[model samples]
Target: MRIIKNLLSACCLILVMNSCVKSINDDLSFVDAASAPDKLSVMFDITQDNTGLVTITPNGEGAVLYDVYYGDATTTPVSLTAGMKTTHVYAEGLYNVKVVGHAVNGKKTELIQKLTVSFRAPENLVVTWAIDAVNNFKVNLSATALYETAFKVFWGDVPNEPGQPFLEGQNVNHVYASVGAYTLRVVAYSGGAATTTYTTTVNIVDPVLIPITFESATVNYAFTNFGGATATKIPNPQINGINTSANVGRMVKNGPEVWAGALLTVGGNIDFSANKVFRMKVFSPRVGARVLLKVENLTNGGIFFEKEVTSTVANAWEDMAFDFRNINTGNTYSKVVIICDLGTTGDGSANFTWLFDDIRLTNQMPVGFLTLPVTFDMANVNYEVTDFGGTVSVPATDPTNGANNVKMTTKTGGAQTWAGSTIGAGFTSPIAFTATRTQMSIRVYSPAAGLRVRLKVEDRTNNARSVETEAMTQAANTWETLVFDFATPSNGTASMNLAWTYDMASVFFDFGNNGTGSVFYWDDVTFLTTNVIPNYLTLPLDFQSTTYPYPFVNFGGATATVVNNPNPSGINTSTKVGRIVKGAPEVWAGSFIDLVNPINFTVLRTFKVKVHSPRVGAKLLLKVENTTNPGQFFEKEVTTTVANAWEELTFDYSTIPFGFYSRVVLIFDLGTAGDGTANFTYYFDDISLN
Candidate 1:
């Protein structure tokens, strides 16, 4: 009786403590009451009729109703009550049908089912195909027939197979993505009553419409005379070797016409999606003759992209390149207009006659220092920011090298001294560093010159292995390409090696300088070599490399970045360190690193890291998991003994079961939730096995 009474009293005390803690927080009441639905299922069966009628049945517990969607011509969803069947007609083809179940508690679940329907051939079909004169290879289709309830088209392009179906009198348009021969087919149906199939051939080839090498058979290339300028296809009239082509476009600009030029209307729109740069041969009347090439849409002549270039050589054929990278691919352009000496009228003399040939389009960037090893910002490669005091954005304003530039704005009240950013910690590809190519070049636009620019490189995971260099500009207020030799820093330290795989890179506009709220522009970061040292557990990991994602897999919204060591001491004394900001809503926000080989437990049983926390007595947990079996894990926790200082914590794993441990995990304040604030932030360096 006494034991039972004591147990009841203990339970009451626990309940009172829980009640007090709960009363302190009320924000969590909606966490569980409103959640997304899960485990929804949808089953469907189509009728054998060529008419795409589909009967859909949705199944899910706790769901009040179902939203059925037939991924076809239909845009609206079919709302179905619980336990009721819904039907949707889909033509004879494959479809990705979706069912979203709505639960009573404001939750939802979804499932997608691939539905295939193959019916007997449709009937009473009338199929017709016409190529779009505006968009090359884009065909306009028409299908009409008596007793036809639906129509289907197999455009014969591999991607448009067993194709989509539509109703009669509907105009179906399809754009062929590539150049090739295609067999266009159509099927008509009478709503599962009868069906018929029709087929035809379509030839799609790249436009040979440009360069007016009239050598080929006489094809009407409508090079019409405009602005009193006339151009005609003729045999090479010049006796010079430059006129090697059998035929060329000869143009004569008559006087009194300042915009005297010729216009060639293309049968299809000029595609500038992939290739934007254009090159054309021009046999000019003289050097410095201004030649402007412009393209405008057939209907919307206002939507156009044009470039003007001067003839470099006199009385000789030369290739003039025009940059049209700013054009939008969504617009159509079919008319090509050329203007000679755009400003001054030309005389109908021998000097006004010119011949040209071999015009083409390409997407290559100009050859220069930027494109040599690697074109910075090429293909829009992502550069992840580790730290930023204010905001960073990519704007296409004034690029020194390519089509874009990166702008960095320093916050007014942000960190003054070392408020910097780093990118590519876990860089997938490492740039190779050689003796001759040990320098990195960058184009910068600073608010003022003479400000020190710092460049740093490190192993994304180790701080002890780092190199930094700084350069001050002699001129400011203008664009300048600065070459940084990776040999010394402002601290008078030299750490450069040809064999080092220095991948992570960071750039600072002003080293150790306070903020003046400045905006900076930089582009074209050129490097010859680049992270991570695998195996050899004896090697301590010091997060020094500027290349990043940092060599760690972070989870639970934890943030980790390599920065200047806040506290470097003991055997892990290094200039760089790993800073971790524990996230909220999770008691265990942490990260893990995968080693190349399994840890030799018998030889090295102690896991060590020099951790610096903001507060003492914070719980820090270190864990190891079997490489092959993540569930097979071992963990140890230690409390921080010192605050705002570095202390080495050694975890003894000698008693752990023998296993291939290849992953190491770290968690700060293991059981206590974090707000991702300054108080929950921590730093660690020299993660090694003892």
Candidate 2:
């Protein structure tokens, strides 16, 4: 009894402890009833078509709740329930079906299933021959597929063997060594399953031989310096054996006379019944000269057919053919004579040098052929602002180069302006426009003689100034068109302005410049849609002096430092050192430090640089000094920037400057700014000359 009472007590204690532990655990891991759900099951039906409709059914016990993922976007959560089918029109592709179920005890389980929605195989595979050559050929295969299915092609010469098939719309090139009949097959496949096969046969034949003939009889010709002298037969002159040798007549260049001559017998007793039209090969120097082939019917002694052919370039042989079916054969004589005649001589210059070969008669009918014609299109028209003293004239004229050409100008000094000044009399307006195209083009014409014009185009959308200019020369009273292609900016807006100017004074006709007979004309400016952009700029050296206080430094080892002052005063001030260079080592040396990665800036069509020089007529040096290779420097002489005041120096960067140059430069030799004095200073700022 005592043992039983003790066991019961122990059991009660264990039971109470177990109950307490269960209560504590349940309280700690309790989940909200609304937040967590019980057993979840998902059953869905999906069509193998493009309409990705999925009907799902969820079945479970306690508080059954479910979350579903159609495998499209996880960010957007989708709640699913039992017996609720959702139709999702998704693109045809493989998708993962995800279902999540949770219990009130904070326990959850996820089940993922893969579903494939595929497109049906395309019906009616069509195959066509793109290129049909004698031995080699190409075929284009095409077919339609179900909206959801991706397709591929299988092709081979055999009907059903394992062969290479390309994707739909692929061109397949096939070559056969020997000419024979071959079968071409195409099979369409969806997913990994073959859907249908298309087969066809192509018959290839050997090259055919055709006979050629001439219409003239035996002829003789003299020699000359012009072209080689050779005799040719005229209308309906049948030469024997065209297929065996591919040649029928004899051609000679060396002769006794200064000019070559030929004679043919038109008398009877010749059978000309085996031939139709005439054909011959002539060899002559291609110095833009002309040669003639003449034929006379034997029925009549008069010449009835003749043809002239021109030669291009030099030292080339060309084939000449003529038809005599339309010739008027007079009654009586039944024979014909032929002659090869070189055109009239130029003042009896020298011996005619001409060679003739391969004269044959053929009965084949001529075939017709066609060629593609060249075509052009235009788009994107815009206007540029011109600063003509706020004048709204028919065409505003630019005063700097003063050819009275119209240009768009901004109130800001040194701002870009556009004008049609190089072209004859045009209108100007301040209407700016942007092009949807990636590229822009324009055509201009010059109407004056001995005058050349330049067209300038400026991009308004780019914060960095960029311009493109093209120069064209024109004959007197002749209209010529010029084209400018500007790369589209990344912003997708391509805005531009056009202008014309006559910068060269040596040319006779200056449209905008001061000249009595100089006039230029322009028209047909246009922009086109393209995907090409300007090649990225390449900077040899970029002097982004982040490490040093001063970006550029100048210190000549032994050269005189006439001026030594480092204060940004907007101009080269006196007290900076000046070096007098004479014979050897003729350079005022300077150094610049680069502190950052190279930055590429475009060379605008037109930009000006300001330089302060001390001396006149002395060469100043502007060089792209590379820190890596100090010896490699691009130097340009500063010719006309020598003035006490700041002188605006302009440079045209259409052509690259000479010398090995980096993006950063060390400038020296201020001879043109001021005389080499003890306190000579050169100031440079607003380096717009790109």
Candidate 3:
């Protein structure tokens, strides 16, 4: 019993000590649920200058962090730790700044501070502006001054346009809508109430056209670039030789495509009918740089034509010509695309750059003016004639030759005595007439022989400066060339004056007689290079004398002319030769020259002629005929052995007896008609008896 009481006393002592330790570890701090962060405020430190810079510092009694909200719509609230400050730029306005402070226990306090941001008047404000170099419609503006915070622009192109805001040292661009001058206004604002406004004038213009010299202030010269090609109108860097304009077009290539180019809308279709050759003055960095000029339809890129040419000189201005004689005129091409250094990628270096000016259209020949030798066979010529005194002239098929085209003229019964038809709407240029060239010829088919055909020439601008001459038609209903000598004018008409500029010509059929429903066909109006009287043709015919008129009577689509030898080597190096172009009309097309007298065939029966043919195995016929009777003729045919070179062809007439034959007739490829191409052209010289 005594031992049990002792154990109980020991356990009771351990329990009392454990209870005392638990009482020492219990919480005794006070708790309040309504307590939160307090004393939240913000300080706004505004700079004294007009620049609306405001520095805000938020503070609170129990705050650990702060959120500052700028009243401007441009920015959101920013979070900052305690004792940190934030700066904000604002225009001159009254704004309410909000501040929120947060405690360590996540309870927040909010405050709204009414801050009045005012600024002084901006001083010495200057606005700098200029037109964009490549784009004339765009204007770039900038400003600099003291106490300026922001800038707003009034482009002056629209009514009630809200100003666009921009900061200092920043350039702003405004593109005008049209091509004219307009007022530009720029306003500079600061932190204070005052502001500075400046105004200037801006001008925009239209795009340039062909013959692009790039010197006009009103021309836009806007080039649309593709594949990294860039172009600008700039002052001429190297102006000499063919191009001396004040400004030029500069092209730089930095593209991956081989055909990178600059295209420009020309606003209208390029008339390729009269002027088929294009010319430009170019200053290339290197020689042999291929430059391509192309034209495309206004909206369709698939309809395009291009021509390429290489520069022959480097670092100097050179004139280049591109022949587009065969371009299709049916398509409408309005855009001009230029590519420099074609077929190669550019590196944006000076070596790949090109300067060009004076983009224009020239003529390979005088295609714009209608001069002599009007055949009515050219594809692009207008050939439109003007009729007077109730006369009408129209293009028609040749009555005798089907392959030839001529003009058919009709005079009504009630027509005037001077009824006539004019050749083209008064020639664009003056007719070439010299002292030795005072005669003109026309092939005419009249209703009756011995009809007086009058040919007159005058200055279209002045009717008093004119000369008229008359020639009689010899054959009726058959083609015959009549020579009109202007040196001997008609009895009452003016004489030929070489000093005047005669640009128009007209022909009158059955002159001095009132029209009685007469119809005539005429063609081949040629201005004779020499007088009407020619030297009579004879044997041993060599076309070397400039004074002798080698008039070969062409018939059945055969044309013969005395020209310089195209290829003057190989057996014949003579300066002059005869060229014959056979066209499509008859299979037996040929030419005959009337000799002054008959040939003496007593000893020499073989005839030899040096001929140059385009192909081998071409049949050449040489025949001798009576001057008046073509039935009494003897002929022999020979074949050529060589091509594009001179060779001697021989014909024997030993079987023919002596006769009065005074005409020499020659025919090439008698059975096959020709198409008047180079392949069907023949050249011959040195005709003699061997």
Candidate 4:
């Protein structure tokens, strides 16, 4: 009976197990038709403190678990249940976070959403800008900031300009249309919505070019130094003479290598077509210091040309010239290298330091003699005016008119009564003072009226042969032309002698009075017969006057005077011809004879003159203008067919109306300013109307 009961219990247990299995199978069948996860998404909670901390919380319907991808370069994905979040630290950037949702039916659902791991606002944002060394109009911009990923720049050159995006330490370039001051704005952005902005005023200008005056505030004079040499732009230590500028370039050559120096980018390839010489004002510590100026290709130092000059004046400023006439013009040069005392090493002392300014290139080489019409405006002319007795003279701008350049002469206190300045070292030629042309005029701006100014001309070879004259200033602080008549000698001075070769001139301001710190400005040193039209000149001007002043007004680097005929044969043979030397470094060099009375053009419309030229095919322009109105002018050009011989040139004025012209102008070789040579000398005489 016990065996039978156990068997029945086992059978009941088996039946109950079969019923449980059938219920499980029915549940599994229902799960097979269930859908995958729906509406899968993620939410990011970023930290506010620039820490780039993000809390990723994923959500989905019918999803039991999720695989969260941080979107960055993470090797493994994070697994999280529903309603659970994971913390991640990311750099400030944009990211597309991915979520893989797993449902109860073993189905997977994946979705990608943009994730932004933004931090707080950027802090301590710094922006820097620099002018491009090669292109003056171009600027390089960069920025740095804490907790910043990228930057946007507003160049402020256009209206409604869009921002340019760049990363940190990346150089953003901008080109300006012109030179001016512009507002530059840079925005530093964190990965989040926070941003930091910095604004600054940037000055745009032309890059440092041929004439590197070291005066531009916008130029990046960041010289590239090598071999332990240091170079910088500094305030001028000694400002006097021709260079009165405020800034200069200083070079300290206390380096280990003898060839230590600095190089500067001169913006572009140096134009060697026009100028071939480089000039600079240098203040050296001692005499005989060699200064080497070299030009090289912008990238290759091996392709270079150099010139060296030695300083003559110790502890004083002097203009030095470096000749680069043999430079290879075919090669391009964009850098200037300066090495002082090139063969010796510096000790970082005053002896090793040099100050320089007014670096420029020119075609005018020093001729060693300052010539007539000293305007002080010519490049590389070397108006080396010497001062004595505590008088200082320098090139200065006109006080009344800023555009007009003049010379400033200062007589400091405790100066000699005869404190004066020489006009220059000496003139290339002597002052030819004829019987009638014995006067010289100077435009003077005095500190006070009634100041006596003395003009003296002497033979440079012999100082004893000098004539001095005095003229009183009639205006104060205004420019007035004062005539000094050497014919009437100053008191206690020798009279003018026509036989002496007066090749040097000197000027004394506030004559006969001890300097009380008086200052004077003077310009336009002119030599003339007279400014007063004492008598009207008529036609048939033979220019043979020993008593009557021809009064030929010269202009544009011309020196015209009446003298003995140089070539007195062939077609004309006469003394006291009009000589014109067009060698004063100008192109439109000529002279005009201003007549007080108009020429008789009604009777004769044709004019003739005898001319002597140095070259054939030389252009001679003869023009006539209204006596008072220079604008009303008529001109005719003639060419010379005979070289170094006398010839008659005819000018017909048939179209020129009567009573309209009183000035007769003459120009030889009207376009070329020749070097000081005999080839530029010309002569003419026997002007008559037919």
TM-score of each: 0.38, 0.24, 0.32, 0.32
lDDT of 2: 0.39
Pitting candidate 1 against candidate 4, the one with the higher lDDT is 4
Which candidate number would show the highest lDDT if scored against the true structure?
A: 4
Poorest lDDT segment (10 consecutive residues) of candidate 2: 369-378
Which clashing pairs does model 4 show? 118-192
**Could you tell me the C-alpha RMSD of candidate 2 in Å?**
28.5
Q: Specify the poorest-scoring 10-residue window by lDDT in model 1.
A: 530-539
Q: How close to the true structure is residue 574 of candidate 3, measured as C-alpha lDDT?
A: 93
- Name the lDDT value of residue 605 in candidate 4: 79
Number of backbone collisions per candidate:
33, 105, 5, 1
Model 3, 440: alpha-carbon shift in Å?
3.6
What is the full ranking by TM-score, best candidate first?
1, 4, 3, 2
Query: How big is the RMSD of model 3?
Result: 27.1
Better of 1 and 2 by TM-score: 1
Instruction: Judge candidate 2 at residue 201 and give its lDDT.
Output: 71
Q: Summarize candidate 4's per-residue lDDT along 155-234 as a digit string, tens digits.
A: 99998978999998788899998889899999998877788999988888667787999998777798999887899999
Q: Rank the candidates by lDDT, best first.
A: 4, 3, 1, 2
Candidate 1 lDDT, 291-338, residue by residue in tens: 898999988878998999888798888777777867888888888888
